[model samples]
Target: MTRPWTVRLAAGLVAATAVLTGCSEKQEANETLPTNGAAETTPELPPLGPEDFPVPAEAREMTPEGAVAFVRYYVGLTKFVAENSLDPEPLLQLSQDCRTCIRIAQSLDEDRAANRRYTEYAYEFTGYGPAMLDGETAQMGFLYVQGPITVVDQAGKVVTDRSAPTPVELQSGAVLLWKPEQATWVITGLTVG
Candidate 1:
């Protein structure tokens, strides 16, 4: 299913600079576009197109707790997946595990394990356009991630100050961040297609 609030995927153009393609964010009913007048402007960006999204609460600051949780989830998720052969848990977790998240989790798991330092993955954030707030637990990403990933050969060296050598098909995903009662910003749910 096409997420109502979808961030357009953009494989960074080979221009002098890289541009991430994502949602533009929408405005709320009580909200009004800034007219450079006495009416103050909100700090958030509107949603992209006409798609509506439920914005969660914003964190006053980037918490260390959040960072650790996310890092652990990402790394552990990567490792646990490597050790065991599961159904689609890896892919689901990696891709926010949406109902139809497309990329094969098992395939990625084996690849990461066998390759180890050989693999690479990239996820794009829509930035603060919509200034999404954290829900009861998770923070919804108004952003959509669509980026190219490359797996490096252990035998091969990466280009200094540049990307790796062997490029692979892009693994696109939409991810959301959630928090456990004790932990903060653990990825909650997602899908690939």
Candidate 2:
């Protein structure tokens, strides 16, 4: 049987994989501005680049909702991975134009020997990044290092850690990532963040 920690680690990696992607979604009006009764304008960031990833930042400078939203999208994408038992689909949900995302997605479908079955997924990120707000478009720094992954069975009770080979924690690559969506800040690119 797989190491118990391996399962936990894989869950963590899966969660990290969901966020640090290269998909580009449509931007909303201005979703980067703070919701502290300030002008709802977008944050200043470079135009959608090829590489993006979640970076470290402070909590006060971020919209708690947007930050939470980013995590939710990532977790949902992980579910996609578990449901389809693939990779690129999870990557695709994170990005619409990442070569890696597309390639990974295709491989998930092509590689039928990947997973034995679909199950539950969960992730808890303990890092921070620059979550910019612009009108309704929010751009989050696309580079992050998510850790301590924990996976559960269909009944929801499993755990793991880094280097467990179960994909538990994720040491994101040297890619800068950002979310380009205007109304919602879905992770849209990968970079060296």
| Model 2 C-alpha lDDT per residue in residues 1-193, reported as the tens digit of each score | 8999999999999987777653454546776755678567755543221133222232112364455455444544544564555544435554546555565457445533533343433444433454555553444433233322333334444423211223244433212233334322444443322
For residues 13-74, write the lDDT of model 1, one tens digit per residue: 43313322233345456665657668776655332111221112232123433333343344
TM-score of each: 0.31, 0.36
Top lDDT prediction, candidate number: 2
Give the range where candidate 1 is weakest over 10 consecutive residues by summed lDDT: 48-57
The 10 consecutive residues of candidate 2 with the worst lDDT sum are 52-61
Model 2 alpha-carbon miss at residue 129, Å: 5.5
In each prediction, how many residue pairs overlap at the backbone (N, C-alpha, C within less than 3 A)?
17, 64
lDDT of each: 0.38, 0.43
In candidate 1, position 174 carries an lDDT of 29
Query: Which candidate number would show the highest TM-score if scored against the true structure?
Result: 2
